[model samples]
Target: MADRDFLLWPFLETRHRDWAEEVEAWAAANAARLSEGDTDEAVRNLTRAMGEAGLLRMAVPESGRLDVRSLCIARETLARHSGLADFAFAMAGLGTGSVTLFGDPALREAWLPAARAGTSLAAFALSEPEAGSDVAALSTTATRESDGHWRIDGSKTWISNGGIAATYAVFARTGEAPGARGLTAFLVPAGTPGLTIAERIEVSAPHPLATLRFEGVRVPDAHRLGAPGEGFKVAMATLDVFRATVGAAALGFARHALDLTVARASGRQLFGGPLFDQQMTQAAIAESAVDVETSALLVYRAAWLKDSGAPRVSREASMAKLHATEAAQRVADRCVQIHGGHGVVRDHPAEKLYREVRALRVYEGASEVQRIIIARAERARAEEAARCKPTP
Candidate 1:
């Protein structure tokens, strides 16, 4: 019943709206049931349930297919209610995203259905302690043996769904070469010999985040995501898709904040009248509404470009993620300010939103990274245009 029509605009179809509403209803009824007393356990349970309900189907497209719009819509709805809900939905997509884009049939058949059924959980293993954003700094190494097995060593930290994932699409250095060129990806199962959980990281908002140490673990060559040194490409491609959805999540938080602020302001009285009558309060409402609309436009525009068959939405996705996240932080701050006293208190939507929006800006390429990406993309476009001159 909470109106998210503002986010739909021309970017969505009736089908998308219907799907979003259906998922939202499912989440409301089932999320509480899925909460397993502990936060991390709850997320794992939600993943299985979401898969069984067929929600994880959108995570992987049906052969040579991609539904970027569906992914964004699902994320938007999930984040609007609970951050954990959004995490459950996103992991379903990203945990196996590398495989979805590039896996062989055996790989796909073996993993896709389990992920869809929520019987198994998936994870992306790219981030390392040294490689927070500069992925070239990854220390994990994968050396190929004469028997066609790959030995994986080193560790990964700050990994989402880390310890809980039944399977991990892992990236590691393949040689002594520098930068991202030496990297490769492999499918490392949870029970793989010499692999163990290093530590469980306790974040502000509890999720199943951890550090994984892979010591002399062997994975078959068939487990590779792509060819040797394609790990960077795999990692970048995955981030490109997920980064935009980070904006969608931000859009959800903003939508919720705006709703809360509007409700609070309309009823709270001042000067022998409702707060809505005050010029200052009216301006605040106008500003928040504008922020929400502008962010939605950017978020869905990126989704449309990818769904329309445009290859690699780096520029648009970066722009969307940057603007939507920064905008959501602003909107949440304004909501807190508008509420005066109750804003900072926990369980109040605004208070939780404030914490929820913080990680969005920091992770998946920070706002600063997005600005750099946008500028570099523009520079590339200008260079391409100059090369194709009229020859006057």
Candidate 2:
């Protein structure tokens, strides 16, 4: 949407650049669907279009490896254009992340290929009404019967792609033990016998979020993603791969907002001079830019860490996600202030960007959760270093 370069110092190859350009062109042309009033049609059409364009194939790895950097880059670029565009691309990767990470060949073959082809819409159903950040509190349970069939009975709220998703990766309590250890991941189809859409959730920005009701929904044991008590582990692995993209999406929104701010502040006049002439306005703009650049560095660094064979990127990911999302919120707020009255107008692009960016701070992992995670990791790393160092 803006002339500013998006890729910060080229974290990718020529293919990535070519793909980003092509997708941007396509996104620019199809941008109308983003403002469409119907949420369901928008998601379905956008996802199918991404699939047909071959962008959706990037969601699944050829073998079992995920390129976190590529996913984050795609989300950043798409989020810069439209939130729906980002959703289309992100759902393709995230919805099937567990399958690629832990599912068996046959399961992967059945779902991953179909997902890549856009024939099947996948979603992750893990959060319950009470299990926002503390996933260990999930009440959804899957019990194995003598018939060897798994019966899942649980309620999942705040689920993305809820009503329209063709399939969902559901994490349920296996009744195996206690706490996070007893959870198991299941591949639940949309049309499963007892599965129902309890309600369609409406948030600030319209998306196909919904509450899922699973009552004795039976699937073969073959659909189990990882071993019992491994659902949290599987979900963590998925989050680790995609969480940076959450920040990227925020960065994209912030970039859009910044462009809008610069355009307005440079031209819009107050007190006989341009808005940019005001000291407060200039300071805000400068602060916003720093946030953007700093956020990009964190996002790419975390992405690089993962791609560089780092065992775990908890601290890096938390820093990236926290900084990027919080920064985007500030950036969007600054853009609104720069635009003055026009920013709040329904027709203004910043107005939409404002709504789109707010969700990133809360989803994936909330800012508070990120802070907690970062503090916990920092403490652990410090303690380990303390223990390993030779005393003087």
Which lDDT value does model 2 have at 147?
88
lDDT of 1 by residue, 212-249 (tens): 99999999999999888889999888887888899999
Candidates' TM-scores?
Answer: 0.95, 0.96
Candidate 2 structure quality by residue, lDDT tens digits, 110-209: 8787788766788999899999899899998899999888999989998889989888999999867788888999898899999999999899877779
Task: Report the Cα lDDT for candidate 1.
Answer: 0.87
Q: Provide the lDDT at 236 for model 1.
A: 88
Model 2 earns a TM-score of: 0.96
Q: What do the candidate models score in CA lDDT, each in turn?
A: 0.87, 0.86
Q: Which candidate is the best by TM-score?
A: 2
